[model samples]
Target chain A: MIRRRFALSPALLMSLALAGLLIVVVLDLPPQPGLAGPVAQAMDQAGVGHPVTAVLLNFRGYDTFLELAVLMLAVLSIWSLGRRDPIPARPVQGPVMHGTLRHLIPVAVVTGGYLVWVGSSDSGGAFQGGAVLGAAGVMLMLSLPREMPMPPALLQRLGLSLGVFAFLAVGTAGLLAGHGFMGYPPAWAYHLILGIELAAAVSIALTLVLLFLGGRSRKVRHDR
Target chain B: MTVDVISPQIYLLCGVLLFVLGLHALVVRRHLLLKILAVNIMGSGVFMLLLGVAARGEGGIDPVPHALVITGIVVAVSATAVALVLMLKVKAATGLARLPLSGPED
Candidate 1:
């Protein structure tokens, strides 16, 4: 019988050793003191009790706006590639999947709404809410038959662009009021942030689902 | 040496480990899908590092990094989607999942 080498490969061992060293260096670094910066001052003016949301939507609203634009750009790039052949639909989902979706989708919608609402004062926010909605959309896509037509293109496009459009409108209004771009008046900040979050949640959900679907809208198969 | 592995340092170490693992996978893997997954893993590692640092900050976790990480997550997802679409386009055009390696003659 031929004897085989059992030791780890040199390259793999080297990589692991390097990683271990890097980890040690990182672990040895001294912890830096927290710099809340202007967060405390902005928090009261932000109109949201959750510090993270306040930071994301108010103090750093410009970042969020740009992030939405980035998402839109990604969708546009995917669309420009034209459509690919759709993955063949599963022959049929089991009764368990169909039943679970029937119950789960409604719960997801309610939970998503609650997440957005509670974001003002707690841990949840637009992204979390949007993800929940997106997950529901994915479930629907997987469970529903391929013959079921997708929503109209126009409606889908509207949903995709809604978040960035709302953000731009708000920002432009702020500029007109001499508050500078993305700066809402302190008194109106709460309502404005809420409006933006709602629109963003919708846009995010639609965009995420589209990303998962890939390329263009799927064509409904005539063979049932 | 006494090591408090349960502390934030451990999380930071984990992030570093993940980053290295992803980097290694990207270097070693020939399949486009694996590369994409490796890139995502790298992105997650960066996010983990950011959160770990945020957790270590005095007076509750810093909201600034948390907000930044949220933005990062969204950006990473968008980037990944674009990458996957590009990969699909490449595969469609060339009928090959992996790109051809550069030759010495070239």
Candidate 2:
């Protein structure tokens, strides 16, 4: 299989040109206040701590939780697809591509880990990193030509559950932290965030890995 | 001198391009998976434009859009899953991947 990067020659030109024009428009236009200024301001007024993180977890957490469930449903849907069909023929050639994927898979896993580690401070996050890692797994699967690439159903389940389980389990840790229902007490805030991020990373990777598996039908054996 | 500036219309165009690309993919692609990918590519493009507009905020990135994108991402995947499952069932019944024929093979 070809390396997965999209060669956005025209897309690059278009995006840049559009971005440039927007620069001019934003300059001509008026400015507006931040959307969450009121809520954040109230937090400051009331002496609530770490309002940014608080807003992310408690105030707007229902959306986040639902997002996690959506990922779960994606996995389940893919899993069900596999059950209905026997398996897809691994028509993809493996021996030729094996060398390249073996080298790349570890690199992807590492990159994914780093993304999760620094997501809070940087652009990388569990979703991005996990997707990257999942790409590596897909690469590996593509390279292996279907003799026996997939791990057992149990492992698949673990991969699917890793993120939601991690996020919710830690969110529940709030009870122990004395912060009640999705609240992270001040003292363990860092640890809790870190844990949630790590778990999310695993979850996202698993989700991406499984996304490709979604509409695949059963493998048909053909005599050459 | 002052810093350089970007126009909001660029943001609008970005959203337009993304939506158009998605539309094109929906029309042109034969593969079930490729169409889904196109849909996501379109989503990312529109989302990028939205984020660009959000950049107009004073503090930094607008959390509201960020949150929305986060929400969108989840919803997108959920829809994707349902679509894929439907596709698979179609494939199982028909033995052919090309749609408009998700029916069973005789």
User: In lDDT terms, which candidate is top?
Assistant: 1
Residue A61 local lDDT, model 2 = 57
- For candidate 1, give the DockQ: 0.65
Interface root-mean-square deviation (Å) of every model = 1.7, 5.6
Model 1: CA > 4 A from native: A1-14, A17-21, A91-94, A218-224, B1-6, B101-106
Residue by residue across B1-106, what tens digits does model 1's lDDT show? 3453357777788889898888888876678988999989988888898888888876668889899999999999999988998898889888987856864678
Point to the candidate with the largest TM-score. 1
lDDT of each: 0.86, 0.65
Least accurate stretch of 10 residues (summed lDDT) in model 2 chain A? Answer: A44-53
What are the per-residue Cα lDDT tens digits for candidate 1 across A2-58? 534665766568779989898878888786776565676568888889999999998
Pairs clashing within candidate 1: none
